[model samples]
Target chain A: MLKINGKPADAAGLTVAEYLARENFDARKVAVEINEEIVPKKNFAEVVLRDGDIVEIIGLMGGG
Target chain B: MVTLEDKFTLGGHEFTSRFILGSGKYSMRLIEAAVRDAGAQIITLAVRRANTREHENIIDYIPKGVTLLPNTSGARNASEAVRIARLARELGCGNFVKIEIMRDSKYLLPDNSETVKATEILAKENFIVLPYMYPDLNIARDLVNAGAAAVMPLASPIGSNRGLATRDFIQILIDEIDLPIIVDAGIGRPSQACEVMEMGAAAVMANTALATAGDLPLMAAAFRQAIEAGRKAYLSGLGRVLSRGAAASDPLTGFLHD
Candidate 1:
């Protein structure tokens, strides 16, 4: 069982989409960069995860 | 090519690449592609009142993880630049600013006196100012003296693709000035940027030329390679220029040549 911000995700290995849904986040409004490469917005649903992977999520705010 | 291995810092953010790109042209896809190809850590954005009204169409263009450097491009003076900088801080979440204060549409040369005056005030307010200036070396020194974080001297004129027109003065500014010398404007080609870097400039900023290119992504990649090559050359100390035709490796006239 992999931890989700210190808590384990539900049962099976969760895709980033499933993880975001479970964690109450709108994944589209933010960007996900795992390790270094920025995951394309379209890949969010297809990107499966493993245990102990470090994910950095950055949210974008309104700007000029 | 430059081999100086030069790096510049803005608001504590360090950047190794000497070529900075503007966020004004091409499609969102091209902008994204060019940024990746350019290897630019700093992506400059300007405020437009129209964007606020059309928020949805504009918001999608921003790239992920890029250090959003909001520029005061529309500001007519230092006072306006300061206000715009403050507002951009709220929007960009950063205090770094690119100050452009030319009022006239033709000849986008900055109002040097006002810029120096404004830089002093902005410095007091803790703003990291990078003012775009004319080819004037004295004005460049004055801006630096007035607490400008960095001074950008135009290579020719904004939006004009004449290339590095201020080479001689740019060299002097870079050699004599303590602060970083960033060459801006009039860079029509990547080779020109390489030339600027080779001349000991800390960095170069290009927009119109890249944006107007038929293949902006390709141009950006070319610029990226050129900047790295130039920086490497500068770091290793570029060989001096030879004006006359003929190799004079040894003493040309013994004591007379000396």
Candidate 2:
């Protein structure tokens, strides 16, 4: 019952690390924002996801 | 006279190199070498959503201790640009952003009004907002009033490699606006980069010119040298131009013929 990048997923009561791992995302290369608040990198393992929580994963890409 | 070691500040950050490199359309393997060859202290990058799989990260390719200037390339308006800038900052890359809010897909021209609006918001949020715009003195003034760190005016359409098609308009901005004017897009050659810098631009940012070159590192070095030479010439104070008269290099009375 959580939104990861606008798609609903059952990640309630899961830590950020578990959610990223379940989604097969390399946490080292992505930054996560939980419910419009940027969760610092160090807190990923400790920040637990709640029902209806929105998560955004940002990565670096080519640009000018 | 300003020495090569003389540094300038943008958004309270000091930089010795006037050249800023854009990281796009080039191999990530060459990014570090290109930056080193260019002697650039700052480089720009873009952000996007993660792919949710194992892949190479662009940030890993950048050298240590270099400033990462993230750009809002996909945003079509002010609020979108602001959001992108905030997301980029949350990634631990400092708050230096290149605000590129282009709504015109055909020409890829920045919407000046929206750019000014983005600058006002980001600047208030403590981001070092460097907004790209078409060269206009009044718009440049509005950006300055909005707390922009610098006003980046395109020399031509994005990725066109046309080289300073808007020279007169850019000149007006240089003559009128007080902020650091960085020439951003459509620069094809190193000489073109030199031309704008010599015309009193505070800096030059080149992407396609280097990305499409035969040798990326060598072309980067060429741009670095050209920018240095142009900045030196500008600091030395160029001589006046005469339309109908010729001025001899040597004194008239000191020549052998005299």
Candidate 3:
């Protein structure tokens, strides 16, 4: 199981791009990080998610 | 008469508008109108977990030509703030990050020491770091030494709309700190914004003042005017106040009876 955004997920061996596509997240608007390391946009397709990975997908929001 | 330029520079970028608007606590549709009415060149944003269910993004509502200042709102420490800043930069916007490290949930006060640490790290990475801090002279100086482009001292608690509760301390930072002192948070009314600007604050950032208003765009415009007026007053040199006695504007000898 992978922890994506602090929630346990069953996704394993799925690339970041594939996970994003499966989740309906627009790739252009969001930034992905695995285990506290930023996964650059250019390498999204190559970076695969493994079991026990902690993933955090972030985006711009309204705030002060 | 020699005319000096009336603009403030932050991280080598010159901005003529002294009002910095916060894009929070309101509908995204109103952002464009508020930005236009506020005449803000720089606007603040937050980085958070992207929701796939929500189709709308805040970046979409921001008009063209305005600089984005992504803030680390949820971070509770220096490293957490740094990580958030890095992720925010990867989102394809510019490298401007507002360092807001808060450990407390209720008051939402910034952790000044952690903020300074984050500023140092971010600035070294070439990010334009603007650290929001408690109104303290020592920490402000430390931030300047830590490579912050500008210092943002809060007037009161975040989103409280309490006005300038830290007036005198903010004044101390404005007087001592070399970097631009941008007053942030808890400015409820246009008069409060004007008061800080008159005290020589480089700029003012507000959100709740407009977000809670019945008319956000109109309130934004009011803040813009007040900020400009205060800047002008600062530039023109405000009239001195008498300590004990009142001084009449009209001369005593000018009266017909005299």
Off by over 4 Å in 1: A1-64, B1-6, B50-60, B241-245, B248-258
Q: Taking the candidates in order, what DockQ does each have?
A: 0.03, 0.66, 0.92
Residues B83-183, candidate 1: write the lDDT tens digits. Answer: 66665554433667777787877887778777887788877878788888876778888888888888888889888889978788888888888888888
How much of the real interface does each model capture, measured as fnat?
Answer: 0.03, 0.75, 0.95
In what order do the candidates fall by DockQ, top score first?
A: 3, 2, 1
Candidate number that wins on TM-score, 2 or 3: 3
The regions of model 2 sitting more than 4 angstroms off are A1-3, A6-13, A34-37, A40-43, A46-54, B250-258
Candidate number with greatest lDDT: 3
lDDT of 3 by residue, A1-64 (tens): 9999889987799999999999999999999999989999999999989998999999998998
- Model 2, span B85-129: residue lDDT tens: 888987777989999998889999999999999999999999999
**Second chain TM-score, each model:** 0.87, 0.95, 0.96
Clashes found in each candidate (C-alpha, N, C closer than 3 A): 13, 0, 0
1 against 3, candidate with superior TM-score: 3
lDDT of 3 at A24: 96
Native-to-model Cα distance after best TM-score fit, residue B201 in candidate 3, in Å: 0.3
